[model samples]
Target: MHGPDSLVFKSDRPWPNARLRVGAIVGHATSDSVRLWLRTGGPGRFTLLLYDCGEAMGSSSVRAELRAALGRVPVSAEEAAEALAASRTVPFEVDGYADDTTRVLDLADLRPDTRYGYALHSEDDGGKVILGHNRLRSFRTPPGEDERRPFQVALFSCHMPYRVSGLFRKRTDVGDIDAWDFLAATLDRHRDDLDVVIAGGDQCYSDGVGTLDIWKLLNRSMRREGGELLPDERSMRSWYRDIYRGYWGFEGVRRVFDAYPTYMIWDDHEIGDGWGSHYLADDGPDDGLARVLPDLADRGLTRDDGRRLLRRMFRAACAVYREYQHSHNPPTDAGADPDADADADAERDATGADTDAQDVWDYSFTRGGAAFYVLDGRGHRDIERDGYRILGEPQFRRFEAWADALDPEETPFMFVVSAVPVLHARSALANADLAAPVRAAGIGDDLRDSWEHDLHDEERAALMEVLFRAARRGLRPLIVSGDVHCSAVFSLTDDDGHRVWQLTSSAVTYHVPRALGWALRFGAADDGETPEGYAFRRLALYTGTSYALIEVNPAAREAWFKLYGKQIVEEPGPDRGRRAVPLSHSVAKIRLS
Candidate 1:
């Protein structure tokens, strides 16, 4: 139980590995907390034969137990399954997945603004030991205090670590920039202007990659001419370790998280081929399949066992984060000067300071007069636009209910967040048709799902209807996202005369391939993204090699999006002398008059 390399959950029956986690990875501040999501790696069979035996909620001593030998009690497998099923502390929701590898533990009635401590547990590692141990981890929760605090926010997203193979772009056209390299640069110049950063998604890759696994058949398909193919699971697993280790393992990005409070989520690359919601089957895993094909989505691969591994990684990390936060509280300064530490001053006015003046370490807090709703888009989303359902019925219901429950009568601004930008780029893409065919192709996302595809028009019609209605009701809607790999702004007019603004920032390091994107010159490409750029008028303003300096004045109902150092694509303006420029996109703030 005390060793690092323990036989996590070794068991007699091994198909259904023993351990699955029930926790979340959260980013926090003193005022509120944001839940990345809570998940459990599932498949109920004879997985890891381990159990979570943490000390009581607030204690250091935990009860460790070895349960794998229970078979000697003469209990039948079904009996044991019943007992285990009855012991869970949280509710479970899962679709049949051959890759029945995960069960998530999401938030239910999470407080609006507050700070919390959180963490997770692991069943396996390197070597031998007991089957049970402590559940405590190093992690902090989203800020939960909504006393109307004042804080700065750093925004960004879209970090695709893989360099595009010639299939999508020319290697000579542009080389890849690691995600951390860009973040370090951004922080170098603008660390003083912000509080925390939020990512839209693509945090990890799911599809087989060349750098990680040149062994899988999937990798063969991914390569330009298709050469080496991974012959087995061991090779595939090796790929998983390589690709993931390459990015998350980056020391620079980890520093950013440690330097500033950060919130993250997953999008397409976290899985594979954008719409895996269409998994073809849910039966137990076979040597041939890694993900489960959803019986519902016409047999699309939705539940890859590989995804569960990634999810487990996310949950475990979050747990470690919670453990860290509780153990190491960041220093706070409340002096009139940002440079001074006012211990006496802070103690005296701790409860009296305006919410707006406090630092945002975890969750959404009331700043100025707006309610910033930052949440997970990929975790809760039901395949988008193809009629697959944007938000699942449950999530959608909750969203509307939350909106209805909002006391708009008392609020002025509503800044909503998704790791991915929510604004529809159809108009911009539509404009691309006027450009070269290759560029026009850029307008169409081959991955558009039921949520954004066949039912896109209807979904848009409905979303506008609700959002506009909310605006008329005095709810200013501002949607922010990050997965697009670019930064920009967008606006929409709702039927109710309400205005919608969207702001997007992508990987402080990752960038789009330059060649496949060459259609830019042929069309109205700004930085080679095409008509979408035309629609948003997105200028790369600053290469993310420099982090973004994002500021939001909740009281004033304004948002400032800027890059910290390098200036590449920017709105037409004078040399402001600052490394960061106010991006025109709504990726960060929502202010309604």
Candidate 2:
């Protein structure tokens, strides 16, 4: 009867082939604790063992003992699964999830600034067996107050594995190169030097051009007639489960998550294409699917009905998001605290009574000397142009509260993760004559979801003002994002000399269209425009698939962005071979001061 907060290990059924699967992960490490996430093949009990990695402990001796122990033990399938549930000798124990699949363990009593060797084990009625015992891995906790150590973070986004399959036309131009192979090589080479991984957004392309399997699942879930249960709840749950299963299946994503602690946030693709950009207003003629399909505009469902159906679909999607993404982070119980604000409930009522749905993913955490403010920008947006709000009232207030509580002088670097690019090239497709019919039909608003859109000017200004205030207070604001499909570095300095950096790394496995990439880099008038009171610049740009590594040297008072790209190479011979080769010369480095 262990609750969600407490760790429990039980495996009702061992997966048929019991190959451990761990991916789609995010880990948050504090001074004294580390939260770990893992996904298994099937239901079963498992054990996690953590050992201190220090010079005093002879590494060779430890390895020899573990190997000998593993070789001596013999385990049957049922015994392996049952032994995991029955054994309670490990330092930390958790019963596998109901299906004995996924588990998030919050491990305590860990030393700060220390790297600990770790292992996963499966036990059953007959014996105890180690899982992936041969591969060595370790998790490093945050530094203590007196420790000052240079740490590195890996940031990347928009991982759509299906893009390389060429089953979809929009990304047909993508070369045969598989970016994941490059990522796997890069991470393996630099795994020891990396501290934590920050996955900006679009980890799974829930909605994208090439995701046929996802759409197939969704189609099966939806009721053909489109009723209250337009999407069967059971089918929606299975779809989300399969999404994670398929996404974590990638070896690149799996290798990183298995080795390091990752922190993640979601973007439009997590729910659907351009989620929150479409409001489905009940009083408007722009019903949900009708705008896209001309004939359906006046046929079956009314505007109110459409809104209801969309709400249900969104609820289902949010539920899955909460279970997989938000549950691992800091608790959002502040929203329910009565004493915090007497009128909080009233505020929530006026803003729209879905407070839980909107605020669960917005949270703040402190590690070492830096703080992370992760935003749920896509969850609560109100696309109506009248009074535009990208982050509805509740989440915005929560962000303000987190900012107000920060003591900038003590925390020199503040990391803010926004799934979508805050500073982006103005859309060339936003105001085209060919898209006018789509605009008048009420769905064109989705095209203008960026911060620079005229409709969202006020909101963008407000966001900038907050960052300016933070900058003035001595916080070097570094915003990391990934949704644009092209990686770039942009910065803005206000009249007060307050500076903020937007380092966007995107499409870890997909290519940006050559024409659109060129337009974003050169054709746009606002590519490097400076506003009235600020100095703006585009420091670097990369249109190919890549990831950004931000290394902060506190003592030196400097930070730099290292962007890496993958090159496709072909060997010419009778035994022709094609492989992804790391292009060392194309490395783009930009200094932040």
Candidate 3:
């Protein structure tokens, strides 16, 4: 493979020409179209050759015809050059300035419930040949809106990439396996298991370990009063892009993405820890993660200064999210072509003082007999003093409208995906006597980040009230989440007899700290008695890395939540060879009434 033109090589890393650094089918998947994302080692024109798998296989002389028509569709190194030259292609040109691009190709009036095969090719801008081509990749169009059949969804989140710029640290004494080994293994083992994949949050930790050095943490004297220990706008953007490139570069993770369409949202770590939790000057001082460089706030900036900085950082991070994650399953409000420009405009508008956390990542879509709602919990957080609203008023109003419009009788199952658990042990800690003492010590203010925080009682109750309204209307809500570094399921029922269930899985790669891990296990255990038919069931809790699979059988009115654990296992050898194992727990099946 030859390299891109000399000018093109200046910006991007050097790589064999035409070979992709990363590729995936992203953005919203409709009956007719899906977005394809690709990044090349160098500048080139990417072309896709699409073929209906069914039609090709149905031919009387499949082998002879395909060979004659497309010349054997070579996958081996020897035959690839010939096959690529003969391949019929659809061109997607990379700008001379950029090597990464996303092309949304129409499926040419594709049929529903059908599989299609696509081969990727690349060439120089002048139609000259380049390097190795992508082998045949295939994806199936989802069933039409009226169709009813069983389907599965894979839910996982919180990937802290290993040793990237030394941001995420691990012990070298023992085997420190990546949790994604389990995710990749699950995708390999359960090849046909899920139709779609949903990543809850913390996909990439931009301001993770390596970003904040000890010098920044200790030396407040030499810095600008209100300036944060953060990168400037340009550096911020570059960091976000690098984080995605490094994290998704893994072949194992890439394979799952290639096989399934993924939908994602961002958490606080996307920008900085506990983002959008700002304190007004009149509200006294900041605390915990909310307390940034206060001297920066004191440096003649307005009370909205923190929020302004947050919005700036968010704008940069949101750019990458729009390109890689939100593009796949954007909010219903975003128009058909949800490009980066549209997202930037929306981010600017949503970043106003009235808006708490800016950037809109909430979205909804339906499949089978169920409707799925992905909530942007991190983006819409109001000040703890401002009634501690978790999802700002605008987001709540949108959710209310969507929920009210749904016919619960027709769509019996309602699935809500929140980055943080809506029902969990956090609620149990609301009334616990820890706040005053903790705050007096000038620490632990980040506890208010949860939905169940005491300051957010009214906010939590309001959200519950709206969800209850949906439950009364006959929609059985199942809230799924993946933060907090632990996995569990809790049942919630109010006095009015409305019942909802919460399932949580977290830390696809990040390991919980020992102190927090012990406390979670000790306090959040499931009591045997289903008191008042409301119970907190500790299905499983591991400080180590894991993921979950949710399978729904629409015909049977049942769903199964399967959790898989990934860990380093010692092989039977004198050297004690170690390997990563992603083994699933016994399936916990539930019947929906």
Candidate 4:
């Protein structure tokens, strides 16, 4: 709000009157809570709102029954870890200086393998409930690894700002329009065939698309085809919420997350464009990815500022995500020490499942009879070896432990990693996209190095060394990723001498560039590689936006990638018409065989 005396006031006091929006997320679960999160655009006295199904899990409208089940919880991202550790629930205070706010509501003492329904609300100054209320929502905890039930997941990444309109927006159908639901449909159709979906980051973009304001009018006009646009942080929040709501508010997506299960690892967009913990030399501690946006900006997860917030929020997100699934959900009341599960961790290691002796802690999940270890590629790095680093020493230690725990055939492990494409085969190495002055300028310094620089032979080989571990051990490896915009595939050689596989699906809604896309399709019109330096050794020629549907058999040591064929899938035959032309459905049995 602007006034003579009052400088700039960013508050949720006025809902539609301002840009503060609400973002809700449900991913990777834990015992007590469902990993519930939301953004508050800016700062003020924010209330932790939860809708009471009042009952248990089921087909129930939970709005009316959800009374003032509100907690006077007050908290912020700046609070000391000690404070966060000690408090049960604190009132959330919105920081309106910038255009963001995010908080994780840890609903402890929940039941395992049960579904809990919920919704969000915001009340500034502890005055009145001004934000979302009674909007039906829910999540399920995971069934323990030994629960005897099979596992499944919904692996996704690069979920973006506008699928409704353009420059940055995509031309997607309702099936694709509601991308999350589309993913849910995929999970639904193949519910029995999968365990969980692993999201490999770039889940949302902030520095992308000028601002959220322009995105709003642009979306409203998708149907209207025209509208007066005013893009800014405030507009961005609502636009962002609308975009996220498209995913979470869907029946299919919500049901799957609530029934099946999922795990997410952050990339640049989760916080903002080109964000890194300390990747940038000049960025302030609260720089690009570190700068806080409203929970609305991040759709209620981690903002685009940096990894610190995500690290803070990861434990929280895991809670809700696990609670929604029958698997992974821990008992909230007390005594169900996740430590109890940790108790057998050593035994798993002894069984020759977890194989490393490195002193580091990392996370791994079990589903579909497979173990997915998310090795962080962005923040934690020891980039001192020949100018490039492997999964760093600490993370590498964690990997060794994870590998030792895998029995090759028992629970065949698929490393659902963010950056495990351990090869660099670029045939085309020339050309530049002066694309449009605007785009060339937009991508500017922010993306040039990323898009322009291809991995040198040295770095590629080093990555392969680390990658060889998974292969040498007779494990079929699968890589899920987002940072790059188009869907592509890579091949890896296992230790047992079998050729493993790596699959990459680009931005769910983001694009590299029309010029880059063209270069990606064919070679550079002028040079063989194009203006950007990337080259594809086995770059399968395909087009349109896409994601991946991965299938793995830990026992068989077999894995395959299913590209969204209807959109980009290319293999066509009579049966193909019956099925769909999968863009990159290359399949190969994996083993150290």
Supply every candidate's count of residue pairs whose N, Cα or C atoms clash at under 3 angstroms: 117, 18, 8, 104
lDDT of 1 by residue, 329-349 (tens): 222221122121223223323
Candidate 3 lDDT tens digits, 389-463? 677777777887888788865677788888878666453343246445444543233555666566677767767
Best by lDDT: 2
Model 2 stretches with alpha carbons more than 4 Å out: 1-26, 54-100, 125-130, 164-178, 188-193, 209-221, 224-230, 282-288, 291-305, 333-355, 385-388, 427-446, 511-532, 568-579, 583-586
Ranking by lDDT: 2, 3, 4, 1
Give the local distance difference test score of model 1: 0.39
Worst 10 residues of 1 by lDDT: 332-341
Q: What is the TM-score of each candidate against the true structure?
A: 0.51, 0.78, 0.76, 0.54
Candidate 1 error regions (>4 Å): 1-26, 32-149, 162-195, 207-209, 213-242, 277-370, 374-388, 409-411, 432-452, 495-497, 511-549, 563-565, 568-593
Worst 10 residues of 4 by lDDT: 331-340
Q: How far is candidate 3 from the true structure (C-alpha RMSD, Å)?
A: 7.1
Q: What lDDT does each candidate get?
A: 0.39, 0.60, 0.57, 0.42
Per-residue CA lDDT of candidate 4, range 374-486, in tens? 75554433222334343465566556666666766656556657542332113222323334542543432233223223322344444444445665676665655555455
Tens-digit lDDT track of model 2 for 1-593 = 33221112323211112223553243777767777665544555666655666664347876665545543466543433232232222433345343336566787877776777655665544444454345545666767744446667788888764442334442322233356566656665665556667888887765444333444334333332522324433334445555655565655566666666678788877777666666465565455454422232344444444443444445445666655665566666422221222144224333444534535677777655567898877777767646636777667677777776777655677888888777754533332442454434443444466666666777777777777788888888888988877888888888767899989898787532423334444432323444335667677877778887888765555688888887677989999898767754347888888
Model 4 has an lDDT value of 0.42
